[model samples]
Target: MTTTRSAADDARDLPAEPTAPWILVLAGGVVLLWLGVLAWQVAVLPERVPTHFAADGRADGWSSRNGALAFSALIPLLVVLPMPVLSRLVLWAPGQINAPNKQWWTATGPRLRRFERLMREDLWLITTVTLLLLVAGQVGIVLAARSGGDAMPTWILPVALVVFLVAIGAVMARMFIGGRYAAQPDLD
Candidate 1:
């Protein structure tokens, strides 16, 4: 005998995929990797530099400071690196709904639309922030070195500061444009 099912039965048959657990796992892994790298740097960096080697290790404080700044800049890159990974994981996972139903599309559509907008916004944001960090961090390292009586052949802090300011300005302009674009909700 053939059985006929109603719409309610069909919805009940549609499985809901859990996304939170995978998101949590991805976040936990990223955090743990960051902590591990930080711990390793703390534990082994001083040994290689040797505290007794120089006066307060000031012969080349720039290296340490620059390293610190570069490391800080890398944090953003590291955080963003997982986006593709998460996308892949979500794509590969079983029971994942590749497409949403009408209700979902109607309800969460705007949020998803905003998320897409933010993705475009982030490209400019990441470029600006990375460039700013690189310039400012180097300037900071140079200023620190010069302050510590370590004579560097070239003092480039002023130039670096200018570049940092320019990057900041560009970032502001891009953000303003993006905000304006996002304000007018276009149902495309």
Candidate 2:
């Protein structure tokens, strides 16, 4: 057999084995946990629950108990579920995904699968973090509702928000750096 571009011409290097996250398995559990917690809290919540909070953690906005419950439960699912779905879309339609090397990676099956696997894990990570954040907010809201005052602890949701944002950045950084491995796509 013969090849072009001398011996220097080699196929692209494949990426590292994808490390599947165990928490990914618990995604369903988290959603269920949120539902359970929301149900328990909503039962005890006043007719009006805090829908919005101020910098000082005061209840700045209000909504009906059912409204709060519906929004809280639905919003988290709406937000967290999409990323995983996008991951699947990336697998089905790699062309829609934006990576470092779009053409070479998607040009072959192995390369595209590897990219999709890594992306699936990355998106799952984001999804898991988002679920945890919403859980924290639910707990905080419950605590605020039970509090003797109209304000929460003034640190719970804010801290959770900051942590969630940081986590999102870290996952994105991992995608840009770790997901963008240098190994050639094919390694032929």
Candidate 3:
């Protein structure tokens, strides 16, 4: 009997990807939502007055100003509530929602591959910025505690150290993973 190659094998050799554009859309929506939330919070809030909430859980005259900020933040969060559904809607656009589990990979794998590429190209800059931000956050925490006559709790230092180590490990792992992906482009 003669052996025959299947469609799967043919697909493996093809350079085409089957992923839907849902991730791209979802990422855009999230960015827009984040920006809208930030804008409303900064633009609508009072300048310097500290609004007081009454002891009975009611807002006094000054506290009415606080609602503007809270509502600004909450409205965006509410608007973003449909993000997951929107993502699923995008996934379904290519009739992928009812397909088998293998089809799901067919959609997400290319996106993951691209992400690995981006990580490879930007790893050094990402790592540098992340490390600087982590260092700055630690400095801020220390300064905040010291200025208030409060010593950071005994456990906090160790916890912060652990978190910093874990973050560094994650960055290293991302770099290693990206390098591995770059080395084996066919596997993707």
Report lDDT per candidate: 0.41, 0.72, 0.40
TM value for model 3: 0.27
Per-residue lDDT of candidate 3, residues 18-133 (tens digit)? 23355345445544545554554455444322232233322233323355455434543464333233333322243332322334333443433333233323333333333333
Tens digit of lDDT per residue, candidate 1, span 64-91? Answer: 6336544644654665443433332222
> What lDDT score is found at residue 125 in candidate 3?
32
The per-candidate count of clashes, in order, stands at 0, 4, 0
Residue clash pairs of candidate 3: none
**Of the candidates shown, which would achieve the greatest TM-score relative to the real structure?**
2
Stretch of 10 with least lDDT, candidate 2: 5-14
lDDT of each residue in 9-111, candidate 2, tens digit only: 1112344345565755667677788888888876788887876788888888888888878877788767777876565565556657677878766666566
Q: Which model scores highest in lDDT?
A: 2
TM-score of each: 0.35, 0.77, 0.27
